[model samples]
Every structure is written in structure tokens, then in C-alpha cells.
Target: MSVCDPSALARSLLAWYDRAGRALPWRKKGNERPDPYHVWLSEVMLQQTTVAAVTPYFLRFIERWPTIAQLATAPTDDVMHAWAGLGYYARARNLHACAKMVAQWRGGQFPDDEEALRKLPGVGDYTAAAITAIAFGKRAVVVDGNVERVMARLFAVTEPLPAAKGRLKALAAHLTPDMRPGDYAQAVMDLGATICSPRNPACGICPWMNECQGRRQGIEAQLPAKLAKPERPTRHGIAYWTARKDGAVLIRRRPPQGLLGGMMEIPSTPWRDDTPWDMAELAAHQPVAAQWRPLPGLVRHTFTHFHLELRLVAGKASANATPLGLWVALDKLSDHALPSVMVKVVKHALAKAY
Candidate 1:
């Protein structure tokens, strides 16, 4: 019954988890161990993305490539296409790389130990810890944002985040129980997500309500304070909607590195903090030379750290015109891996067509 005792705290949380844990696509039921492939895929998709956003993508990925070996053998472009709308395109690339590594060298079996798992592509401390505990049933500290918030409120830790991260992880490590460590880890995350929310928490029904010091102090909502983040800078670019006479659009694969890597994109000038694109620069980057007219509206999309403004221009390819990239038929665009931003460009261009 002692809240300060890690074993007792874990026991209380696990009991709640047994009744209230989320029925996610990857989560296994009672006495059924989690699949490491599902665990890895779901965790990767969940990064910088919400559960609502990731659910369909996870389902699609699993449906298409059910196993790690299948995913590794699948074409990287296909993976990127399937992962188009999911931001952080680099994760998709690393996912394919990791899958290939695991399939080829590890004999398609994910490593159970934290140290061994950490060596895999895109598997960092948090991911390695999560895989070790949730998939392998090993005792490992899992300190995701949800866990950090839960710890901060449970113990009334007052230091701001980033600086407070170390302390929070230490507390989470302490509470990480040897018994049912996997369930305990997920239970804490579920508690944070469903009950100890960042806004109005449902502490009345929280299993740890009586143990919560932040609630006693009347600041559980504000417990895990954070330093203010700097404003996201706005970047400007131009999206050229180059349509071939055959109703195909010119799209190119992004460079292997950098933002939106390995995804298909409408031909565009470099996205920069510089001014709205000058018409003269079109000669350098435009897919083909033709009469270019400005589209009616601009496409605005936000990345994690920046705001993007894209002006669209339309031009048709002549019979002799040979563009630099692949010309995908308009209706078949869905088959290609256009990032969300390029999807906007296509929509904007199509709006002008009708």
C-alpha cells in the first residue's frame, strides 16, 4: 500500500492496466507475449505522431508486410509510399534499413537485450528499453513522455523538462518493477495518456490518485513544467505542377538524406528562409520550359520546427518536352509516395482543373 515503494506502486498500476489498458493493434492480450515486429513498427510510427494518426498506417503496414522479413524484402519505395502521410520521413528509411538488417543478418529475429537492440538502426535508448521490456519481458526503464509526466505528478517533481528529464528517468527506473515489467511499463504510459492527461486529468478515477503529490499540491496539471520553445521560423518555396500532355505530372524522388527523404515530391525550388521564389530562378529548377501560370492559392504546411509556404505554378509539357523526373499518370498518383505537402500541391492543382 506504500506509494513510495516501487513494487507496491507497480502492483497498483498493473491491476488497473489489466482492466483498462488500451486495445491497440500491437498490444497483446492476457498471457500473450507481444510480437517484436509489431512493437518496433508501432513505436516507430508513434514518434512525433499521435495514436489516432498512426493507427491506420500501422494497420496498413502490417497488412501489407506482416513479418519483418517481408518488410525487409519489400521495396523501399513501396515502404516510403505507404508511409507518405506520416511525417518524419527519415523514420521510414531507417525502418526499411533496420528491417533488412534484422532479416539478413539477425536471421529475422529481433534482439531481446537492450544493448543488442540499441545497435539496430533508429533504435535508441527509449526504443531499446521499450523493446526489452514490452517484447522481451525484461526489466528495463521505459521513460517516454507519458511516463515522465506520470512520474513528475506522482512525486511532485518541480524542475522543468529537458533539465528535469534525468531526474524523471531515474524515478521511472526505480518504479520499473521486476515482476510483470512489460505490463507495468505499458500501464504507466496508459495512465498518463488516458487519466493523467496534460490538460484536465481524470485523477478521481486514477489508480494512483491517493499516491499523487502533485494533486495534493493542486498543480498536477502543471507539475512537469517546461521552458518555452522558440518560435518556428517560416520557410518559403514554389511547387511546380508540371503536367505532361498525357495527363501525367512530373514528380521526383527526394534526395536520400534530409527532410522528406526518399519520398516522391512535385518539382520545387529549395525550401529556404529566403523570399518568395523569384520567377527567374524557374529556369534552373523547372522540370520543363512552358508558359507557367500561378495557381489560385498557396499550400501551407507545418513541420515540427518550421512553417512552410508554397506557391504553386502550373505548366504543360510539349510533345518534345523531356522532364527530369518520372511522369506519373494523374489518377495513378496514389501509387507513388507523395509526402503530405506534395499531396497538397496535387490537390491545389486539381482544384484549378475542375
Candidate 2:
């Protein structure tokens, strides 16, 4: 193992990065400067999402709205529709809001400083630090899930996650060098993702293998311990699928506040932890007076906090007038910004239509 000095560690990691850094769409080669807009967009999409899953979406977004100004000028519904299947709908809303703030208020320029960047919607600590370091060529302690694992393994941190995050951040900050901080940040992230993986880490090829305290102790794989996650609570609801004779569907916009807010959805009963399946309880929340028939099976989805099971009820609306919500033509369903859950509800109801 080489000396356990911070400078030595930084030098070793950056040298390895020069040879083996992963090629990503958001990254720049050699001395080329990175675009802050791209960095912010990619970082926001990466939250709670994998890189493989986000790559196509990122490309699609860039192709459609090439600049922050373009994105800011786009309709909110358009952005929401583009963000369909990304799971977290709130990120899409915040991304649009942040882009508008940057374009309209800041004149299409992102603030280079971490503190100022954090004020933007969806720009958290890690994201702010990443944008400052990578896009603006500033020194910032950028820590994400990958960095946490690398730091925990390198320092042989024994405390479980959530509890050890503070200590790990401090250790990471200590190792952050002043020279080429952006490359160094990317290097560490690459090392963690490729070498210090969660299971069966490739310690032999790691640049910091000799310097890793966990490797010396033969506990690299088990260094960053995590507490057991509690069982997620299951919630139940019923979605009403009312279709007119002309093939128009009744859909409503969710209140712009909580989960799946501002997204289009079929009218439904409130999701509750103990919702009863009784006919009387389900009939009360029906959107219009119709002979509703319950579809077989349930539309199940998992959110960050809970599991949701939605029952689908299909019925024919007698009148062309939709008193509760808008009547969208079946062919134009894609025009609305419906979340994945609502899309599933619609598909299930259509498949079982009489």
C-alpha cells in the first residue's frame, strides 16, 4: 500500500481516471468545458434512477429542448408528458420550474456557486456541488451514493449508513484536492461505480487498492453497512374508467400538490391504507352516474414510500357532457401528461372493456 496521504490518494485516483473513466453523454473529453445545463439536467434525472434508464430520456429531452431557454418556454404539460415512465413525476415539475428560473430570471445562465444553485428547484446539496465542480470547474465536495460507498470502504467506516453519512462526508471533503477538482470528482465516482461496487468489489485493479483501509482489513465489501429497511405499507384505491359512446375518456388533473400532482389521471377514490372493497364504499366515489362494472385483477405499483393497488371500474357515460372533468378522445390520450400508474389504469380498463 502506498502512503495514506490525501494528496497521494487524489493523485493515484486521478491517474487511474485518465485511463479508465466511463464514457457518458454528459461528460466532456480532455480540457473541454462541460455545459452546466446538461450537468443539471442529467443530475436531476439521475436521482433515484439508473444511468442506463436515464440515458435515452436525457437524449430525448436534449433533442426536443436543446437549451435551458427552450425548456423554460415549453408548456408544463409537454414536459410532464416527456417525463412519463421516469417514475418520479415531481422531478419533472421541479425541472421545468428550475429551468424557467434559470432562463427567465438568471438570463439562461446557471449560478456557478453551490449556495446559489441550491436555491433552484430540485437542486439539492449533492447536485449543487456536482454542477459547481463539473460544469464550472470549481472545487466542491460532491458526494452521492457511489461516493459514500467509496469513502466508507477507503476509510473502513464501521457505522451504518444514514448514521455514518456525516462522517463520510467529512472524510470525503478532506480528500478533495484543489487541482482539477472536476476530474478528481468524476474519478472518484467512476472508481466507486466500477471498482468499489456493492458486491464483490474489484479491489485488485482499483487505484486505491493499496491505500484502502478496508482492503487492508479484508472488509472492503462489508465496510459501508446499511440498516434493514422496514416493510412498505400497502394502500388501496379504485380508478373509474368512464368512456362515452364516441370513444372519449373522462380524465381529470390531479391537484398540483402531493404525489403525481399536476398529472392527468382517471377520476378515482382516495387512496387509503385501509380502503374497503365494499360496493357501497366504492360507489360513493364514482365520478358520474353510470352502471360501473369492476374489472378483474388490480393495477399494482410501488412508490418510494408505499405499495399501491388500484381496482379498475369500467362504465359507459350516458351523456356527452363530462360534468366532473375533461373528455379526451381515445386516440389523443398521449397528448395528456398522465403518470405511469394512470396509464396502467387506462390500459387495464380498455383491455377489459365490454
Candidate 3:
């Protein structure tokens, strides 16, 4: 019940972690300290993404910038461009802003504690805890989805996550050791990722296999249940593939906020849930009586919040572009900050047009 007297379960888990932990690049050896910048960047990139998915991004980012100071001074366009396929563009924006703040305001050092770390843009509870523990060797309990699943299964927690999440966090806090806080955090994450997996867990090799409540109860695979998500709603829109007589294509920069913010894309009519107006209905929405021709297919994309069906329309324009976008040279399209979906749309258009 108290922090000093950790449960038998907690002791067992940490002991196993002491010997069986994996050696990751960002991790410090034995008594060495970890880099705050590396910890912070890795944590941010890992959000809503798997370790496998984030590894390459982490390598690419560090290769390009190498240090927090370099990242701080890098241009926003370059940062956004490097982060093109990373899905969450907002994180990229916040990472750029926070890097500059730390470099200029904090003397190129990440704050040593949770409060200062949390004050930075995009650093929330999980991020702050991770940075504090890993970067500064502070004793902070880091609870991410991996930790949540690990704790939930260990305690036979059946309340279904989001509801069970609070108690699971409390349990994890009790288990977190003061010594090797950074290693301990990574250990638990590794345990969850490799051993206590969501599907087909390798329980026999797990450190806590003997004490795990879910394993004891023979429900390791189903401990952390949750309400099923509603079927994602679908919407329809029209993407205009305007091209010059030459090979240039029309593209625009999205506004600096919502989904795919700050990325470039082919001009598109509004996306909506109600059936997209046919060619006639689209003309009503356009300000000018421009000529439009529908492409043979629809480009489908799924966002975290919604599913999108974009009707592709190809048209020709003079060097005089319509209000939304500029005519971009086809061969040099890679330079633009395009979302993966937009990239797909552009590639599809170019393949057919040229």
C-alpha cells in the first residue's frame, strides 16, 4: 500500500528487468547518464506510434540535427519536411518550438524536473515523466500505453482501460524503483512490448510471469479490455488536379492548424459527410466557372478521426492559376511539405496526366 514497501509483484518485476533488459541506443550503460535531448525526442516520436515505427524517424532526425542546439536552430520548413511521413505534424511543430525554447531560454539544457519540462510546448504528463526520469535521473513514474497494458495484465485488471487506467498508474508508481529510474522505465516498456504483448505474449520468458495476476488467472491475453470503438464515419470531397499544358501541377499549403496542417496538397473542394455534390454541385461551390473533368477513381484516406473519400478531378489551366494553389513543376514535387495522402494523390495524377 505504501511506496517504501513495494508489493511482492513489484519486486519480482524489477529484479527480472535488472538482468533481461535490452540495450537500446538512447539508453545509458550501467552508471552513465542519458542525453536529455535524445530521451525527449524519442519519447515525443513514440507517442501513438510503435517503437518499430519510431526507430527510423529517430535515427533520421538525430542524423540530420545531431543535437538539441542544432534542432533548435534548424528552419521550420526543414523540420516539417523531414517529418513529412510521421503522421502527426503538430508534434513536429511543437518539437521545433520547444527545441528553440530550450536552446535559447534554458541555455541549451532541458529542465531538470517535471514542472519545467511540462512547461515546454507538447510535453505532457507522459513526456515530462519520461524526460525527467531518463534525462535527469529523477524518480518519476512514466505511464504510457505499454506501461498501462503491463500493469493492467499484471494485476488482473478487468475494469477496461481509460476507467482502469487510473488504478493501473497508481500500481505502476508503487512499482517504480528509485535506483536506475531511467533503466526501470525502459525495462517496463520493453517488458510490455516484447513479453507482455497485446497478442500472443511470451509469458514464459517474462520476468513477472510467476507473480503476474493475469497469468495466474490464465487471462493474460484479455486483462485490459475496453469498449469497442464506433465505426469511423466516412466523408466525401473532390480534389482538383489542375495542370498546365506543360507537366506542372497545382498545389496549395494547408492552414497552420488542424489535420495535416502546414503540408502542401493539390487543391480540393470542402470535405463533408453528406454525399459530395456531383460535378454540378461542385460548380456551385467554386467562385469561377472553371472547366473540370473527373478522374476515373476516388482516392481514399483514413485519418485518426475520420475516413475520407476524395474524388479526383483533372483539369487544365493557363499559367494563370485559380485562387488556391500555384502550378508546381512535376519533377521537383519532392521538395514540397506534402502529407503522405497528398503525395499519393499527386503521384496518381502525374502517372495518368504525363
- How many clashes show up in model 2? 0
State the lDDT of candidate 2 residue by residue for 61-102, as single tens digits: 999999999999999989999998886788999999999999
lDDT of 1 by residue, 1-354 (tens): 655687888888999999889999999989799899999999889876889999999999999999999999999999998998989988999999999999999999999999999998888898999889999999999989999999999999999998999999998988888998788888888898899998999999999999899998998989799999999999999888888777888898889999888888998888889588888887787878877888877989998889999998888889788778998898999999988888888898899744
In model 3, what is the error at residue 59, expressed in angstroms? 1.5
Give the alpha-carbon lDDT of every model. Answer: 0.89, 0.89, 0.83
Error of 3 at 28 (Å): 3.6
Which of candidates 1 and 3 reaches a greater lDDT? 1
Candidate 1 colliding pairs: none
TM-score of 2: 0.95
**What's the count of clashing pairs in each model shown?**
0, 0, 0
Tell me the deviation in Å of residue 233 in model 2.
1.2
Worst 10 residues of 1 by lDDT: 1-10
lDDT of 1 at 189: 84
Candidate 2 off by > 4 Å: 1-3
Off by over 4 Å in 1: none
